[model samples]
Target: QQQVRQSPQSLTVWEGETAILNCSYENSAFDYFPWYQQFPGEGPALLISILSVSDKKEDGRFTIFFNKREKKLSLHIADSQPGDSATYFCAARAYQGGRALIFGTGTTVSVSP
Candidate 1:
């Protein structure tokens, strides 16, 4: 089973509209949450992240809202652009050493000009 989950497997938006991506996790031990964006034929890259202690985190056009108690988080992309189109993955990592990040299925976002 996937420890992390994403909603709206796919999404589309106008160039200037905002795109919202949702994520949830199953492990309470997960203390770190990172959102990754991947372009076609490219590896996923970290976009933004938040710790369980934080309620919100933002970077430029991307923001992440976290709810530790509920084990949920959301990524908001402001000013959606066609070049922003890509697959987004929500991931979680525990303090356990020697472990790679666990990722959610993914959310594909398409921005139309």
Candidate 2:
């Protein structure tokens, strides 16, 4: 079964607008959330992440809004650009000491100019 899930399997946004991606998890053991951005032929790169202790984490134009109680989170890309078009994956790592990260189905975002 899928432990993590993402909504809006695909999304489109105009340049300068914010692109929002939603994610949820079924495992309560998850404590760390990392969002990855992947290009067409490249591996996914860590974009931003948040711990279960915090409600939000922001790095430049990228931000992650997390709600531990609800087992939900969202990634918001501010001032989106065409170069930002790619697939985004929401991944989670449990606190029980496993090195594996459970990833969501992924959300493909297209930033149009």
lDDT value, residue 7 of candidate 1: 94
Instruction: Estimate the overall C-alpha local distance difference test score of candidate 2.
Output: 0.96
Pairs clashing within candidate 1: none
Off by over 4 Å in 1: none
Clashing pairs in 2: none
Per-residue lDDT tens digits of candidate 1, residues 1-113?
88899998999999999999999998888888999999999999988889899999999999999988889999999999999999999999997876678999999999999
TM-score on alpha carbons, each prediction = 0.96, 0.97
lDDT of 2 at 25: 99
Residue 103 alpha-carbon offset, candidate 1, angstroms: 0.3
* 85: Cα error in model 1, Å: 0.3
Off by over 4 Å in 2: none
